[model samples]
Target: MSTRSTDPPPIRSRIDRALIRGAAGATAVLLLTSCATLSSGNGERDNVPEDVSTDITDEPVELTLAYTDDPPSTELVEGFTEQHPNVSIELQQTPFTDYVKTVTLSMSSDEAPDIAQYNPGAMRSLIPSGHVMDLEPYVEAYGWEESFPEATLEPLRADEDATRFGTGSLYAVPGALSVLGVFYNRELLARAGVEEPPATFEEFEDALAAVDEEGIAPFSVGGLEVGGFQVWNTLLNAFGDHEAYRDWVHGAPGSTIETDEAMTATGILTRWVEAGYIPESANATSDDDAKAAFGNGESAFLMIGNWAAFEMEEALGEDVGFFLLPGEDPDQVPMTSGSSVSYTVSSGTEHPDVAAAFLDYLSSPEAARIQLDTGFMPVDTDASTGEGGVLEEINSVYGTAAEQDGIVPFPDFATPGMIDQLTPGVQGLIAGSTDEETFLSDLQAEWDRVHG
Candidate 1:
């Protein structure tokens, strides 16, 4: 099993610092302190040379990688080295809680790794400072645009300022993917008279009501962390316009989240709270505790991602089932929030070609198998999902989303402080202390602080 902490890092302070410095003077300051500083080459964006090559050196070469996720990272490194026997990668890992700050500092220091795991919020500073290489040249050379899914690559592109993403130069490449969905307890759902998974949004609400009427907790929520907003996020996916939401998240000019559809989605959660569908103590519940409760059958459902599939399947076996949260129109394309275990090449790296080669391997058929075995959706969606059960269910839904061009970045990707706003804002909604307008307004305010 992976040892990465499920807990999100304490992000407010580090993120704010990175944004402020990244937007203004972070690059200049970083260059002063680091020996591996890039030259301000004439007319070059991010100081990356126009002449990029896809070939790696056959002679002995060594590279270091710093990352948080292990199941894929360690095994992926081993896989790459196995293919290119002359190249060796030394792995340096940090816990998820410390990964952002640790990597941000190290990537600017003389000791920067050749590659580092990419976190949009934490690593925004690296973009402007030119600490990370812009990979558009490599993308053209390797024809990644043709091989990788466009939906997966969209989140990795950002303008130079880092204020917006989903367009502009590519900074990272995905190795594995994850999608948000609902996990239901089969026995509990049957007990509540839900014969099968709901295919429409209204049907989903009826299921929740039925489960509540049966005296079973309808949902297990992790209000203390990302679970709460993720619930809202899924609802917004069902009710809101996919492109508008993506634009807002990408920091498009004049985009806003305070919409009628958003209000409608938030109102649904409010009604759920009033109906006691969500637990009263949810605001204090951590994600792990909430997932554990669902696994033990204390709750009828948990809205989470595929990352929880391994443990859920292990605990409940055939009793646990997975499905994407249905949309308002049953026939509408599936839209859901997803992210990747993606990697970025540091500009300071001595072996840019080798690092890029590692990224390219992620889309290979062999790497796809490692991604699947490690409990993540493979970067190559064409790879076969496992034989049966929750893992297959997840891959099936994720494939549909990817094929339809319906996947989107998580809302927290909008800005660094967005998570700080979302966690507390959703907590107030669960506690009935914050109204829908207030909750959304708080989010927009945080976005404005960074991107206005």
Candidate 2:
């Protein structure tokens, strides 16, 4: 029943400025040197200083944070400053499309903000340039390892080369959590004679077929953007090897996406495309358009993250429902890809301890309430939603995945530019212009280019 403004601030102008500056600067940095060389003399390679306490002085402190996500960012900052009245936080909001590029330049610049949102695309360069702080010390002092979920922290860790993940030093901590899943319209399903949410892959397809038979679009996907890949990601999680997928995404040496599981997942998606489950014009549709279509009752299902929950609820009321994509069998181990709206401290911050304290505050019960109110899952998994609805359903499924150690990082996270490959590759699959082999091979090639 928590309420807060979920509308993101307008950032088109800011995004344009940030993208121009970031692309020009980041490109030069990427070509001029390797990450190892840039990070070599930072002196932070060793453990964080033991005396680097979490304690902040009573003297008034003002900090700047550069971020893209608004609801949680603005609300979380309010919660932190309410507790520490003397401290003030100024937020710099940017559009997600421009965030990675822009934040990279900002982090590397001399007047970097005290804190910046964690973007892996930017981190590959920032972590190596000694611009971002290694937060292991703050983690120990704050006991964040215990406060936050391990799966939430794994993707944020990386080697000095910024290649491998799920190991090495911790860099960022999640302020909020989100899981990818299937969102369905209850009325649409009922019209199609679906008694309940599907329990297995076969049943899920049956529902799709039933919906299509009733002249309804069975699925809504924005193949032009991340939506296309997300559909494949959910399918792979349901059908593939979790450990292998994790290893590949984490940049483990010799890890790959070319496997029987991946092939089977791709083939299933191909079959769905051929069966007209996914619309032919999906490749031209934007993510917003697809979400709108689902919200307007133009489609029955949306394969996306909980970030869309608030909007869906607003549009469909109690008619909208959510569930994790079912596996081949009902008893298959719970698994899905998730990530955090996380942040990192800047190495140039004058108030490192204060920044760390802000990060620590994210795990508090107060911040958990803000996170859920702002349409994000709390880092503290046990935080209650206090009632039953879509959020409860999501938490139920996400909780099961978390408890069983089944959550995995997203596939696009495998490399800096993997999204570029995945989007078009999925577009090809949807268009029937690419085979399963080409799609996975393209992904592995991007991984090898970065990890080699």
Candidate 3:
């Protein structure tokens, strides 16, 4: 979640410059292929079996994978190789900042990896290029619809144009899942005389006031990066209409973010900034800095995804706890933005059956254990994560949402350059340089630019 550039230059300066370059490069490519549809590898049918096979030949097979996320990807690969001794997987790791660009280029080459971590930005181009396999046949064969959560799979589905989502062919399957929530310092809350995690947004606000009164920074926010919009995103999930938000994020026709619910969510964020619940220095902070501040006990709360769980637990141990951002009403169905460290097979792979079997392994009970141990929500939502702790707390809350189909795609996924818009828009909001109307308008404008 940090995503702070290692360059000596400012984070915003670097990100903005990168976005401009990326957008221009993408635009040139898009124009050249605007008339194209998702290709299925020159109409040559794959040699994969129609039914999911339980046993693969004992003959040795080798695969190469390109990925960014570590814990899950590395461990998942280890788990897969352990099960099938005859298969060997080689990994090519890239930094998160360079991953999209690097993976996209490599995947387009004739020597593409057998499997690569799925990135929506790259997939927009890769899908239409016929380089990535459409996993519909495998999905049905493996009964992945029953194995993986529906919400997780929905975002990976796209039309032939690779424009609209939630329908058409599937592109990938999740190796591990994650959810967004609030990570709080248990000692800080107790010090402020708050007994437990707030079950409603009203109570959460009150806790913020109490903590502020106790001379503590209520929330640690990294307004300089994705951290800022992540806060706005959490609030929007709690306050907005889930289906409408989902439709907009998935590029459904006629979807819009300029709703009364979105206005209410934005107002709540602005009010928090004004109330000093979110500090003025937040705009200058990096996500790593914010997480450090919270872990060091300088702040009471940090809003982020489960990906931060390992570091927080390492830094704070039992002092930290997690809970979903509570909704406006206590009885409201819980919702949050979540995604997976998913992988896709290359159409160029010589061992299609071996590659598909590796994917199928992701849903197995053994892989679920590896997923939980690596601090990610398992693909099997019903998989047990053991007794009480921050992970248990996360699993309990995340399971409820997944069962109710409340996990929605993140807002930035709506468009390729949307993060550039969301990050800066939230930065302006915190700085009082942009009004609520302008912020919402900018978000909707970006959506229109991409989906129109």
lDDT of each: 0.81, 0.81, 0.80
Backbone clashes counted, model 1? 0
Model 1: CA > 4 A from native: 1-46
For candidate 3, the per-residue lDDT at 300 reads 96
In terms of TM-score, the best-performing candidate is 1
Error of 2 at 112 (Å): 1.8
TM-scores across all candidates? 0.89, 0.88, 0.88
lDDT of 1 by residue, 1-452 (tens): 01122222211111122322233321111111112223455734353635566666667889999988766787778767767777899999988767778888999888899999888865578888888888888898889998899999998998987778999999999988888889999999899889899999899989998988899999999888878988998888888888989998888988889999899999999999998888999999999899899988899899988888877888899999999888778999998888888899888887777788789989987677777777788898878754788888888899999999989878888886677788789899999999999999998887788778
lDDT of 3 by residue, 176-260 (tens): 8888899999999999999899999989998999999999899999888777888999999899998998889778988999999
Which window of ten consecutive residues has the lowest lDDT sum in model 1? 25-34
All models, RMSD in angstroms = 9.0, 9.1, 9.8
The CA lDDT at 172 in model 3 is 87
Give the runs in model 2 whose Cα sits over 4 Å from its true position. Answer: 1-47
Measured on C-alpha atoms, candidate 2 has an lDDT of 0.81
Error of 3 at 398 (Å): 0.6
